[model samples]
Target chain A: SQQGEEDPQALSIQEGENATMNCSYKTSINNLQWYRQNSGRGLVHLILIRSNEREKHSGRLRVTLDTSKKSSSLLITASRAADTASYFCATDRRNTGGFKTIFGAGTRLFVKA
Target chain B: DVKVTQSSRYLVKRTGEKVFLECVQDMDHENMFWYRQDPGLGLRLIYFSYDVKMKEKGDIPEGYSVSREKKERFSLILESASTNQTSMYLCASSFQTGVSTEAFFGQGTRLTVV
Candidate 1:
């Protein structure tokens, strides 16, 4: 089963605009991480936010987590054509004796140049 | 730098044939994973191993099996290849540094089962 689900299956905006993607999960998670994938390529880790953290930022990326609502959002400021890619949010949950990371469906973001 | 390398970048196999997709990580990470990416289904975990000779089934384990004889290597096997099994296969490795560490992924192998 997919533990996390991202809203807005697809999004398109101008190069200078900021893009926001939201992810909602069902169960409690120890941490949430966002990843980026270009077309026909593997995923790359972007940023991670622990459950105890409410927000985090790295470069142009900003992530916010709300445990009470089981949701997380990724905001990309000053989007560029190079930022055109698919974004996914993953939840790291403790299972059995180890941790299992599950990813969401993902949001396809297209930054028009 | 952490490097996870998949055996092949592109593969073509016939139906009913046994297929093996190999993955190797140079970081000596304890955890390795195999995931399949589809058009709309994102990346779905197929199998993962936390230690040598230890394997666990992921959400979509049907039609797929895995082998981890060495700590730095993980192999995903398809008993009998089918057209539906053709997709992008990704290999990743991560160390349990703290609560949950980030994973490093390979370029991915695009497999086509005819």
Candidate 2:
């Protein structure tokens, strides 16, 4: 089952613009990770934020988690044409050592060169 | 590099034929999963294995079964293929949640059942 739902099913932006996408989850999660998928390829792991972490950053990618609202947002600063791909948010559900990760529908981002 | 490898990049099979999709992870992660992705439905879990010889049914497991005889190898079997089973299949592996939350994925296998 899909635990996360991504907002803005699709987004388009110029090369230098910042792109932001939000994800909402139904249940408590131990951590949330973001992945990027280029056309006709496998997904690449981007970043991960834990439940206790309100915010985290890696390079130009920033992730914010709100346990109170059961939501999270990913911000890509100074986007590039190469950032054109589908982004998916995954929730690592905190269960009895189950280690199950549920993925969202994903948001497609297109960057204009 | 850590990796998950799928047996094929594409496959064409006939309806009512049995099919097997194989995935092997060199990382030796404790958890492995099989998911199917459609045009817009996103990735839906078909099954998962936490340890060798152990399996759990996911949201959509009625038409599929999984085998995990070895820790590094996990296979998805379609007892009887149907046209509705045509889709892209993805395999992923991750360490125990406490160790790492990120999962590494394999290049998906595009299955076409006619």
Model 2 lDDT per residue over B1-114, tens place: 998999999999999999999999999799999999887777888988889998888779999999999999999999999999999999999887563468899999999999
Candidate 1 second chain TM:
0.97
Q: What lDDT does candidate 2 reach at residue B18?
A: 96
Residue pairs with clashing backbones, model 1: none
What would the per-residue lDDT of candidate 2 be over residues A1-113, giving only the tens digit for each residue?
68999988999999999999999999887888899998867888999998899999999999999999999999999999999999999886544448677888999999999
Chain B TM-score by candidate, in order shown: 0.97, 0.97
How many backbone clashes can be found in candidate 2?
0
Docking class of 1: medium
Instruction: Give, for candidate 1 chain B, the lowest lDDT window spanning 10 residues.
Output: B95-104
Best by TM-score: 1
- Candidate 1 C-alpha lDDT tens digits along B1-114: 889999999999999999999999999898888999998898899998888998888999999999999999999999999999999999998986556679889999999999
Quantify how close model 1 is to the true structure by its C-alpha RMSD in Å: 1.0
